[model samples]
Target: MALEGLRQRLTDLPQGRFGVAVSGGSDSMALLHVAAETLAPARLCAVTVDHRLRPEAADEAQMVARFAEGLGVSHDVLSWADGPFARETSGNLSERAREARYRLMADWARERGVVGVLLGHTADDVAETFVMRLGRRAGLKGLAAMAPVTHFHGVPFHRPALDERRAALRGHLSGAGLHWIEDPSNRDPRYDRTRARDALRHLSAAGLDPDDIAAAATHLRAAEIGLQHLLSDWATRHARTHRGANLIDAPALFDLPSDPALRVLGGALRHVTGVAHPPRAADLSRLLAALRSGDTRATLHGCLVTRDRTGIAVLREPAMAEASVPVPLGATWDDRWIVIGPGESGMSVKAVGAAGLSQLGNWREAGLPRAQAMSGPGVWRGETLIAAPELLPDGPFASKFARDDFPAWLASH
Candidate 1:
């Protein structure tokens, strides 16, 4: 493969400062070199995230920094610590590290006023991910290839080489007299990705190469986009939001094929709970079956699902709101609600518990489920209920959904 096309694509990007995430790997280092070739060094900023997972990680970051300096490109090394997984010795360390890395990178990009960050995901990644997800029996969305452009943690990310291969990038580096770090974890069988990489060889020998699988994943991505359109249409016709709860027309939802129905229900779960992804396939399937079988209510993913005259209602579980924190007057709380009112120093936001609910005699008249209302954001001053905006229309404070409306939320995620 030639670098001419990649150079053209890089040149076509909008004129502004763009960030590049380099991990001292061959793919990323090649990307950095190509980007510096296409754009001004001042327009290209390199960022390296030292996950501190391995001993050599720090030195690797410094190596990338020095390499960037040689290209006249400024580089910064961000360290990751104090995340939720920082102290945990087990449980999906890869996923936790990935999430933390993106969060740190997003913040860094925003702070530096970078327009977007460029990534180095190649075709091999798409194929390896597909193989890993195949083992989990993933559906279209899970099996689809990563988009060339996507958003994470509200930051834009661009992958200009999803169509390229790892070997080609390494070859490009070798020809340029450049070198890259080879993280030991690449061969660690303890990780799923390493196993996926091993599986790729056997798969290639069986007449299916990475490019072939990547092309198939591209097809699946197209199918997933079409389904998203269908999902948005269904949401407009059958969904409504009340106070933070999503009320979906049960008859319309139940009439949908299992796939679309599951998407609708899953999107609603994420919308209500503000979680990034839906519940696991097994758990979501069981919950869907229970609902169709006339189970009145169920709980999963910090959300409560119940039947009502309107249809199925998905709202934040009261238990999930038990750990309330001091409200930042204009900022969001619990990732769901925003309270606008006087910024009294000691005021906190908590769920309207039974005692607080008793104070709001008109809560029942507000036409919300007891549990949903109980979990509504209530402004308080040391047990002194100041305002329950969802219940009382006239108050010093007002509460509203911090996120988009149900349909838009469903479509975007």
Candidate 2:
């Protein structure tokens, strides 16, 4: 009745090219085996990401690759060269690594034309996540441990195995004669998850059924989903997008239920600006304050959300041309524009690519000063490129002045 439950659940879902993010761990190995046996091997892929954080991480990834190969499944080992990012998210190292791993696997699957990428989250893990988030002052959304299906970036993500008990996955791996790598980090107390995980184990012995916690998460997730849907509709009905910024009337917003209004505003912010505040009590408070305040403009995570007499306009902070770099490199760098003329004249400028010095001959002829540029962070002031850049601008036009102020010659055209 245990492992069979998961196999049956998977069987009920639509069949497609499936993958298991084999972390060289028991649950993931079981996920791999079940997916391989249930779906066509040609359709199943196992992806292991070598974060390269640990000295033995590459070896662990190889172990996962070999296991998947032995199962007659396609396997891959991706390595991250960027050294361990010194980060402390609401969740600790393991949680961040899990997020990175899943995202990498999703990217790999999508590139290879796979429809869905899978995770091996089990019932115990789900319960533990909810308990941890609950203690961390998470609202309803955070309390919902994980969604069964969602999109990460653009790839479809699935955790079909989450509802299955950990023991079931372990038993399945045992029955299938599969072995897995043990991550030493799992036992490290430096992480919050390990502590919460141990707490969940202790609670289980004290008569806490994993199913009961999972049921609570399911209910919470339902509420979260309903709220998200309602918020999306509200945003469409009331929110406005103009000039790459967003505006929503304060009076219109105040009319909605408080909880849903927050959700709608938060969701709108997320849509406009990709990065978002991790669900936490402090983050919620800051977000609410911004929503309620009279400040016409405030910046969060690089995007400026301003509430004026009209409404709120969320625009990306403009950048001045940093040190002279080859122009038009999309991922490498964003190009810059400039305005070098009288403010009263109402001059404005827009240009693409930081080309060679020859490209500036025209702007120079227009008689504007160019700032000696360094890379990364640099800016221009008025007709002259300022040696210094304003960290924040009072308004968008002045901000443009603070940027690489070029001759409006091109913009006028």
Candidate 3:
């Protein structure tokens, strides 16, 4: 059954080399085994991320490596050895660890030119996530649970076992005479996921079975898709990007229902700041309220929202601005703009601040507000500002904002 499901998923993916993340757990082991059988030996690889959070993590990674070797698949173990929980200053150790793990795996995949990385998230994991998000009062997107295929930092992630049960994967492994390691963290109870797992047992007794919960998540995903379509249509009609900033037609955005309006604004802010997640709900609410009240200016999420005679503009906040840094030709700047440098050496790019804005010879001719112009990219040669992309027609250098197609951007993280 697991093999059949995986075969169907792989069939829909592009024809190329693929990789799986295995941690010697039952679900991941089953996925690696099934993938090895489904794809040619040359097309399959495995990666194990040893977060170094526990004493036994290295041994577990080696065990996974040996198993992959037995299957005639190439395997590599990636380590996070720089002080375990070193970046957990915010008190969310698990969240930090998960983010680090994905970053490591995505970097590895990109370096190896793999098409996508497979995960072993199961139906039981999806159900647990739904319950966990509900406990935290997550909004619709969070309660919708995980998608079968999603992208992180442009790396494709595929969860082929999202429709299968954890017990079923373990049973398949047992029948094949294979043994899997049990991670102690799953039963530690200190993590929210562990607690949610315990709660699911009780909820299952009350007729709220994991399958039922997962089915509900699937329905919510459909609704989320509908909402995204609406957002894309609205953005196409009302949102405009210029000079590395986003401008939304105030009246059209204000006329939208609160939910869709918030989503649009949230997405715009994220795009400008190049942040993956949206700002806090309360922060979004406050900004929306101020916008609706005709407030002139507000700031959040490393972005500044300003209202003028034309429309509401979302630009990078001058306070959180990026400092001048030497940029190589064709390098990305401020995570949003790509710097197109002159062939000359020692060129640098930085935000055009008030001082730099005054030196622009055609600031008024560009028709951008002073504040917005200050946020645009400025190319410098030593102490002199040679070109401001927004203010100049065609200079020695230019910066282009990375634009996304509305529909595709709406669907992604």
Pick by lDDT: which candidate is best?
1
In terms of lDDT, model 3 sits at 0.81
TM-score of 1: 0.83
Clash count list over all predictions: 0, 5, 0
lDDT of 3 at 264: 90
lDDT of 2 at 270: 48
The TM-score values for the models, in the order shown, are: 0.83, 0.73, 0.83
Error of 2 at 204 (Å): 2.1
lDDT of 3 by residue, 204-223 (tens): 99988999999999899888
Lowest-scoring 10 consecutive residues by lDDT in candidate 1?
A: 82-91
Per-residue lDDT tens digits for candidate 2, residues 1-413, read 45666677667666677767777888888888887777678878888888868888888888777877877998888765443662433545655665666556655785677777877888888888888887888778888768777655445677888778877787777776767777887898876778888888788899987678988998988877776666655665677654234567787777877766666556544444333233344564576567677764555544456676777655544332322232211111222222222233222222222432232344344222232121122232234332122222232332222221111111110
lDDT ranking, high to low: 1, 3, 2
Candidate 2 residue 62 C-alpha distance from true site, Å: 0.8
Cα lDDT of all candidates, in order?
Answer: 0.85, 0.59, 0.81
Model 1 over residues 234-278: C-alpha lDDT tens digits?
A: 799899888999989888989999988998999898887666678
User: Candidate 1, residue 115: CA error in Å?
Assistant: 3.8
